[model samples]
Target: MRTLTGVDSACSVLAGGCDSPVRSGDSIGVPMFVQTRAEGAYAFDESGKRFVDYVMAYGPLLFGHTHPALVRGLDAVAADGLVWGSTHRHEVRLAERIRSHLPSMERIRFTTTGSEAVMSAVRSARAFTGRDLVLKFAGNYHGHFDVALLDAGASARTDGGSGSGIPESVKRDVAVARYNDLDSVDALLRGREARLAAILVEPVCGNMGWVAPVPGFLEGLRERCDHVGAVLVFDEVITWLRLGLHGAQGRIGVMPDLTTLGKVMGGGFPIAAFGGRAAIMAQLAPDGGVFTGGTHAGNPFCVAMAHRVLDVLEAHPEYYAQMEALARRLADGLRAILRKRGLPYAVVQDASVVDFKFRSGPPNRNYDDACNADRTAYAAYYNAMLERGILLPPSVNEVMFLSTAHTTEDVDETLTAAEASLEL
Candidate 1:
């Protein structure tokens, strides 16, 4: 194997030298190391430098990279075969397990990515209601799909066109509302009740950092959705098992009409699913009208990994508790360090997910507030931490995920590095 000097060699072949925009480190104007390997809570770059990883592959590695059980499960499945291209037992078993935990998902359909799961769920909502308009909260990203790319305008009232190549017709049918502000949603539903298909939101705001739902916010959305007959869709792709075994809806007690899940459910594999009431899910063909199909929708390897992920979650419920504790400890330590440095900072945390903003006041409640955070200060802190061999999410707007593999010692090491990093 040949090792490159920096991201330039990697970028020579790959666009931006990274698969994802966030991985590019262009936002922070820094060179992101090319990771060659990862195991447990650490990732190694091409230079063989090991950094304690807090990104955790952006929330898919609940058990951390190359977890022994996950690797073993995949090995077992590979021994049998990779893609059966037919309905498999593991897929059925995993669906049953998901439905058991998420009772709202009385029926489920598997997909290859979170984007597909969300797209299918939205399509189902439109079909079930026979409506065209779909409402999504600002900064609550569903995925990179056409419908999900629409943004709120400068007035924060008009629907801004797609940020990219999405069609105008598609953008016109979508509306953007302020997150955690139920009144904004109610206002949109009031005039468009007849045309409203669904209200899509991240139960806990993960994309714009970890801004959780305000008290009664989710319940309010549920009420509005029920009142307007719009399908309430919870995009729990990032929050699912990370919030609890039952997900944010289960922990918050505000169930949605349809739920999209990914990330931790895949156990580091590429798998995603969208499900809801039997009536709604039945709408998908070959049973009903809304078309959704993929060649590798429920491949055996991904299904086996998902099954093992669920099995681990069930057998050791203590993993959540331990990870949450570590998360809290890390948050508290960072908060103290920031205070000692006299820097204006606020740490927003939900269970094992944590994000810090370089602001003095209370944590951000919505997208606008998150945007107000000092990105320049965060970039300095990020580079400082990286120098100390502690890896954090490359962008300040992204959340740092803690996994079951992270130890108290890891948290302590992070804090020690943080204490020094804050000097920047």
Candidate 2:
């Protein structure tokens, strides 16, 4: 494997030809020739090679690359100003737009990244309930906030330990539990019932692939939080803009007390947000003691782009239907190919996000189950796909994304590559 370093070579080196199977050079991990220009559904390499993008900037390209509408909207917003360090019109408009899309959000606050949004949300929970500790499920990521809670970072130490630089004390304060086990959460909530400030979770886990919460899992969390007076935080960083407008909250109908949103919020731009009841949100900044501010929190460009993106989602409720159909088509196609090849594999999917796990049983139920997936076979398949010009997230843990810009053509092409890649 070749190893290239530095920012300018970030893409070329890591994505060039020298990576390992863990740096495997095929399929989703395939290298682009380094292009100068391109837009929509496809990206160009430095050599001007056109490849359909399945990575989609880690699932933020809901409308695909450089949609003219988004470009024009951003251009208009930019003509007025770039960053005033002051709230622009898009702030109120975007908040209203988000709330309109997700009725559960009574108040919203912008942040520079998903991590900040999660941190602020956790802080709000503590201030609202006057508590300290937070609970999160193993394998369900909610950013890297000190106490915001999360599972293991990389694919080591199954019990989930202090991920390197994380302070020992920080890890100790943040509790972790098994995903899909309401009993585990209950035990923790009861053990620290009154002291529990919040319970953060990804309604549909993205890090270890799209593992949807077990039936009644989210509802049970909601009930437990209500019973203990702890805030229930839905970290929708990956599922936010991609899983319809209201996200998992809307798809599941179990609204969370607070939600941290990221992907697609800025339309490939750096943006994220958190929101909850106004009563709890009032505790931030000038309103309450909890402090949350960033010079670029609500940058005019990000807000403007996000506003336009939301408009696209809001205006076309059927977009998700299309996404679901295409996702299903792609997933079904791949699974059929595998079954025909007698490959021990299955597809775990929810809406546009999907993962190809080389497991024997039903789709994974938890991290333990996900661990059973054949990483070697997956690596081989990934290599095959990359060689076929389909790009995928490097790690098997990362799920596949289908953007709005992708059409039936893309899914069909992907499946054609999938069949060829899995040919062994």
Number of the top-ranking candidate, with lDDT as the measure: 1
Q: Work out the TM-score per prediction.
A: 0.95, 0.89
Candidate 1: stretches off by over 4 Å: 1-6, 152-163
Score each candidate by Cα lDDT. Answer: 0.84, 0.77
Count clashing residue pairs in model 1: 0
Q: For residue 187, give model 1's deviation from the true position in Å.
A: 3.0
Query: Model 1: per-residue lDDT, tens digit, 87-186?
Result: 8778888898998899999989999899899999999999999999999988777777788867631112223444456787887798888888878877
Return the TM-score for candidate 1, rounded to 2 decimals.
0.95
Residues 1-424 of candidate 2 have per-residue lDDT tens digits of 1122332375455554333232333333343233345588886655455667777776788888888767774566678877788876779888988898887789999998898999899889989999888888776656655554345432322343544455676665677877889988777666678888888888988866678888999999999889989899998988887877778899899989899998788888888999988889999989899999898899888887787787787788898888888889988888899889997667866787767787787776677877776777777776677667676766666788887788898889889998888778
Error of 1 at 408 (Å): 1.6
Candidate 1 lDDT score at position 220: 90
What's the CA RMSD for each of the models? 2.9, 3.7
Model 1 residue 326 lDDT score: 93
